[model samples]
Target chain A: MIKVRNMTVAYSGQPIFTNLSIAFEPGKITGIIGPNGAGKSTMIKGILGLIHKQSGDVTLHSKPVAKQLKNVAYVEQRAALDLTFPINVFDTVLTGTYPNLGLFKIPSEKDKSAARQALADVNLSEFSQRQIGELSGGQLQRVFVARAIVQEADVIILDEPFVGIDMKSEAEIMSILKRWQMAGKTIIVVHHDLNKVTKYFDDLVIINRGIVAAGKTADVFTKENITTAFSGDLSTILFSDKEPEHA
Target chain B: MRSIGLFIDGLMQYNFLQTALITSILVGIMSGIIGSFIILRGMSLMGDAISHAVLPGVAVAYMLGINILLGASLFGILAALLIGLVTLKSKLKNDTAIGIVFSAFFALGFILISLAESATNLHHILFGNVLAVSDNDLITTAIVLAIVLIFVVVFYKELLITSFDNTFAQAYGLKTQLMHYALMLVLTLVTVTALQTVGIILIVAMLITPAATAYLLTNRLSHMMIVAAIFSVVSSVIGLYMSYTFNWASGPAIVLTAAVFFSLAFLFSPKQGIIFKKKIN
Candidate 1:
């Protein structure tokens, strides 16, 4: 479980998030829904202690999140990676184990075995030796997921993991998250698609600059809440009772 | 046949040959290690500029009768730090800032060399005479190469993470700026140390060729460093032999041998090389 209290992040005197508070419970898939530049990624980064939060505290399992790097795993957006580095699928997944291994020691046989098992979980065992650059977008995303699995952390934060991925990969990722939730891991995913929130997320944290609403997905998916969170204009277009095509 | 045997005997007895071999190896190791990071960060041109910019530092030091390595390292470090800071702080692009600093520093060195032509042999400062390498220069180069290698290995993870994704590394609580400056410092020292053997015109080849060849052969950073170091040592030895046999400049001969390795890597490396084509079907 993760607890964020009165968190505010700023960059160059401009506040990215102000007076935000939310809790991500264990054993549930929590989807963070927001418009572009609405501080969703910043919030996740703040919790992971990746950025300097102007004022706030993020706690994981009753300890400061900053001190618990080993307890958390992160899957960055695929767009942020360099695909031409010549790293293979296996090596890419093995990097997730680095924080645990520290600086000096090499990856042991156990670590290699764990990486292989993680690949197997994603049905990518056959592709372990393939060059990362040769993989498709969906396969790359799955490789990142395999890395997170190999990390075996208590909480996993994925930033826009589904972006540019096909529907099958997206569904495959959601199923994996569902299984992770069942195994009692806290999952926080930054998502853009409003349509899939009801189907995939058990808890929804709708954010626009700050926490607009945070609770069960079914209760928070109301037309009024959607409209309020997205600033009424776009929400009306998405949640309108009548199809716009008929009009 | 009798005259040739006498000439060979004289050549074998010269102390300069031993000095050249040791100096070239030390310079090769330093340049190869530092050059790996430079090429990885896409700062090869910056390395070239810094190497050239040290010419004035050497010229000034020779004029003042000071240690050339110390003087040139001080200047190179200053230039490198200034370039890094300016690029990070200002809106000016990195390549443009490098161009400006490189041209200005090199031009200043040329002017100083022209002024001090009456005091010393300026041509030696420019092209360098490997046959004239002293014990002191060899000792300094060896010390510098060892220091550079140790520092790189000790800070391997931090350097790798920072070089790969600076913003992410900073977010993860690593000191991105400090690491950046540290790499620049190492690069300056490496450039200065290499200048004793390779000179400014050929220093870039020594710095970049081994690393570029290693890059074509390996994907892992640690493995790449090992491969680069091996390539550099072999090329330096081969180059020295060619220089001795053909009666040519050691610096160009070493660089030409390294270039041959690079061309071989390009043509025959397993994954990305032109000759080793991937199965696309």
Candidate 2:
């Protein structure tokens, strides 16, 4: 299990959240959904130690995640990467193995083969030699996904992985996540689409600066919880039978 | 062509010619390797800032009777550190921070130069006179080159990962802060080594142009470094030959040769050349 205890997260001295606690069960596909400015991304980054948390304990199996960052694979938002950098996709994917390779060690042939296999799994085997900038948005996302697969991490965290991606790539990524779940790995994703939340995730952690509800998708993904999460203004549109993107 | 051959032979005959040729080539190779990272990170302005930022240190070193390279490297790193600090502490963007620090250091350099007018020649420090290479200068350049080369080779993967995606670097426990400082240290060392050959005014061009030209030609970082190094060596050799034959200023000649190569690459490179791309209907 992954546990976040009594965490207070702040950015530039402004508190985003206070006394927040959440637990993620093992071998589950978890979605963190929230409105804008709700600290959805901030919460994940805080857990990863990418952002400073004012006070918190984020642990996996009762140990701090910071001490075992190698056990985690993270794919950041697409906008966070430099697409025009002069590195081929193969080299980019190979970096996933770097944390495990440790200091002053190069990737071995086994590692290269593992990276190649991950690329093949993502249906990007032929595009390994292409520059990252030449790839379409969906293809680039899959490339990063392939990198995460090569990491062989116990916990995989993806932020906004489906935005701007094609439906085919989305299906492919979902299937890949399913396969990882079958292997008993933990998958945490930050998502925005309310329509697919229950269909895609087994567990949902809903928030709007603080946790509104968190449990199995069927139990916690309710009209009242979502209404409270988005506030009174969005409740009508959110509960409307037809799905619009949540605010 | 005959004059070129005679020039090569003449270069072989004189010890000063040999020293100037060897030092310029070394400076060219080192600059190309380090500059590959600079252009990739889109830190061209930062490169310019650090190169110019070393000026005050050089002037101060002259007054204090200290080794100019040591002083210059310290100030170069100080400039980079200050630029990073300002960008973090304030809302100013990187280029704005660069502008503020580089111009201030450059202005301070001029003021110090005037104060030390009797001890140094401003022209030599500004444009460089490559033919006046001292043995100690040669040794210092060589040592700095070796150190920069070794670090780049040893940490090539870490550097690549950090430069490509620093957030991923941080998430994966790559010590990106340390990688950044290490790169800044290498940049300072490269600027210090190029001080006597390219001088402060044109050192940034020497650092950026070759790598940028190679970037136009290749899609891979390793190939970029190799192609840039080759371009650097060829341009340095031809520029030195031109300087020897025509009595031209060596620094401008070298930089101009590099610029010419960049122009050619920009116009005719098969992959990314602006002029040669097939137009859409």
Candidate 3:
């Protein structure tokens, strides 16, 4: 299980979340859903030690998660990367093998095979030699997913992976993620699509600067919970279609 | 074409010409490799800043009778670190940090040069006198080049990962901050090495122009490095010949050659040039 206990996060002397705690067990597709500026990404960053937490204990299997960050495969938002960087699709995926390769070691043939296999898994084998900047938006997102697959970590964390990609790419990503979940790897996604919340993830972490609710999607994605989380305004506007299944 | 034959003859006959030619080639390779990363990271201004920032160290080294490379490298690394630190700790961006720091160091360099009674020619340090490279300067340039080359080879993957996606690099347990500073150190070393060959004023051009021109022509980083090295070595050799034949300053002449190549690439590169790009409907 992945656990974040007594966590406090602040930005420039302003509190985003305080004394908050959340847990994510293995073998689940978890989506951390929230409105903008609700600390969804910040909470994940804090847990991964990507951002400084004022005070927190983020443990994986009862030990500190920060120490074993290499065991975590983190795919940042699509826009965080430089698409214009002079690298081919295969080379971009090969970077995932680097953390495992360690210092003074180049990617060997075995690592290259893994990268190629990852690319194949993502259905990007034909575009392996193409430059990253030349890829379409959906293809670029798939490239990042290929990178993450080559990481071969027990936990996969993606921040806003579905944004700006086509629906086909979104469906493809969710299916790949489902395969990982079945293999007993933990997956955490920072998502905002309310209609797909119950459909995509088995577990949901709803936050509005703090944990509004966190549990199985059917149990915790209530209308009152989302109304409180989005402060009633966005909940009505956003959840009018699907209504959170049990809300 | 006949002048080129005469230039090759001169290279074989004159030791000074040979020394200048060899030093210019070595300087070309170093700047080409280092500058690839510099432009890719969007730190071209930082490269210019570091090259200029080493001036005060050179001036102070002249005053203290110390090795100028050591002094310049120290000050250059210090300047890079300070810029990184400032940008990290404050709301000021990287360019703002560079402008404030490099100009201050440059002004201080001039003041120190004025205070010193040493015989180190400020004009030579600023504009370069490639024809006057001594045996010791040649050795220094060679050593710096070897070190820079080895570091790049050993850390190629790390540098690529960090430059491409720093956050992912960090998440994968790579120390991005350390990688950044290490690149800065290499940048400083390259700047110090170029001090004698191209001098401070034109070093930025040597570092950026060839790599940028290569960037226009290549889709891969390794290809960019290779193409840039070719451009660098070719331009420097031709520029040296032009200097010898015309009695022009070697640094500016070499920079002019790089600029010419860049112009060609900008207009005619098959993949990215403006002239050949198909207009979208």
The DockQ values of the predictions, listed in order, are 0.30, 0.82, 0.87
lDDT of 1 by residue, B132-233 (tens): 788888888888888897888888767776665554455445567788767876776777767656667778888889999998998777777778888998
Model 3, residue A24: distance off in Å is: 1.0
Q: What TM-score would each prediction reach against the true structure? A: 0.84, 0.95, 0.97
Off by over 4 Å in 2: A231-247, B279-281
- Residue B232 accuracy (lDDT) in model 2: 86
Candidate that scores best on DockQ = 3
* Residue-level lDDT tens digits of model 3 in A128-229: 999999898888888888888988988999999998899988988888899999999999999977878878999999998999889999898877998887
Quality class of the docking in candidate 3, CAPRI style:
high
Instruction: Pick the winner on DockQ between candidates 1 and 2.
Output: 2
Which CAPRI quality tier does the interface of model 1 achieve? acceptable
Identify the runs in model 3 with alpha carbons over 4 angstroms from their true place. Answer: A231-234, A237-247, B278-281
Query: In model 1, what is the error at residue B139, expressed in angstroms?
Result: 2.5
lDDT of 1 by residue, A178-210 (tens): 889999999999999887788889999999889
Poorest stretch of ten by lDDT in candidate 1 chain B: B164-173
Interface RMSD of every predicted model, in angstroms? 3.0, 0.8, 0.8
- Model 2 chain B worst lDDT run, 10 consecutive residues: B272-281
TM-score of the second chain in each model?
0.90, 0.96, 0.96
lDDT over C-alpha atoms for residue A15 of model 1: 95
Candidate number that wins on lDDT, 1 or 3? 3
